[model samples]
Target: MKILVVDDDIHILELVSIHLRQAGYTVVKAMNGLEALKVVDREWPDLAVVDVMMPGMDGYTLTKKLREDTEIPVLLLTAKGEMEDKERGFLAGSDDYLVKPFEPKELLFRIHAILRRYDKAVDRMIQVGPLLINRQSYEVVLGKKSLLLPLKEFELLSVLASRHSQVFTREVLVERVWGFDYEGDEQTLSVHIKRLRDKLEKLTNQVKIVTVRGVGYKLEVSE
Candidate 1:
């Protein structure tokens, strides 16, 4: 899963990212709320780890802005441990809240809990043309065949299928699928797209990931 970590402290950001990456999560970092918004505009991470204190925008406003458009999970990780602060975070749409000096294990546990709950409540099955993606099952069916795909590839396809015909820039695609802080270049996305294309070609030729030249790519359904 992809997680966006927002904090003014570089040490905190790095510490959090390290632990999250070690736990097999793609980590995206933002120094403050402004950068967080830019990252969110393109990335749409599965969850956000935001600190309450910052220079430009505080965590409360950031959470509020995020809740305005997306239902993506938000977890407030801050130094404020007061009951009032926790209540404010909840009111701001934070799904979970953890104070500073927290154990990394506890953080991980909370993340898993939130994700599990969200997955259960959400309808993750998506139908795009002849392809059917069961995210909860981590499987995809094309025509009559059930195909197995690597995690990243499956997620990439899921994102593309989620917004059929909408062109996604390489940057946007990487942010959404691989996380905004992905270390690989655009070549990585190309490789995955190629692999997806090869597998998809075996299924049929009606649906395609169309390249839009200067723009990026779009899922083209020939009907």
Candidate 2:
């Protein structure tokens, strides 16, 4: 697979590119966001590793531009590790975020995880009655309306909708949706499920999230 490395700092850019090459990935280098876009147009790399701080367009803007045009996954490599920074990166359509001064191994691991998630969801479309879930675009359409959801909520819904009527255990759902390394308890999953349920209920009566007494949740679609 080909990977694009975008960073204003020459040393950091080279460092990331070398690591990706060592992992058997073809590497394309770009100094800034504009150059990165040009490289994207030419190289058509499978994924991009971008630095948040750049000279012209920042990583967030570049991510938005890429999302607007392509389904290529983006991993934001930034020094900003705060919650708000991570939130901004995700909101800008980044597939994942890693704070700077990170281990190359960790970076590779995140890239693999993102790629695996994308592979599983690529071209996958789930329809339940009037509700439609397009995994590639992260879009949820109910009847004639599109419902926007936060990243986690969207992921949770996709997981359930992929296997509607199957009773998924809380542990399994949490692992699949939030990752096994998630530090929070099951309450986080519950909260997101609640939000998804509320949103679906507000839009349609045919699709429902049913909670099993001892188990987790299942999505039910009525014709």
**Local distance difference test, each candidate:** 0.88, 0.87
Superposing all C-alpha atoms, what RMSD in Å does each candidate have to the true structure? 4.9, 14.8
lDDT of 1 by residue, 1-223 (tens): 8899999999999999999999999888999999998887666678999999998899999999999867778999888899999999999999999999899999999999999999898778888887788997778887678988999988888878877787788887888787657797779989999898888788768778888898777788886
* Highest lDDT scorer: 1
lDDT of 2 by residue, 1-223 (tens): 6789999999999999999988988788999999999888655677999999998899999999999987789999998789999999999999999998999999999999998998887657888778889877788997689987888888888878866877777876776777655788768887888888999999988999999988778899898
- lDDT of predicted model 1: 0.88
TM-score of each: 0.69, 0.56
Clashing pairs in 2: none
Candidate 2, overall lDDT?
A: 0.87
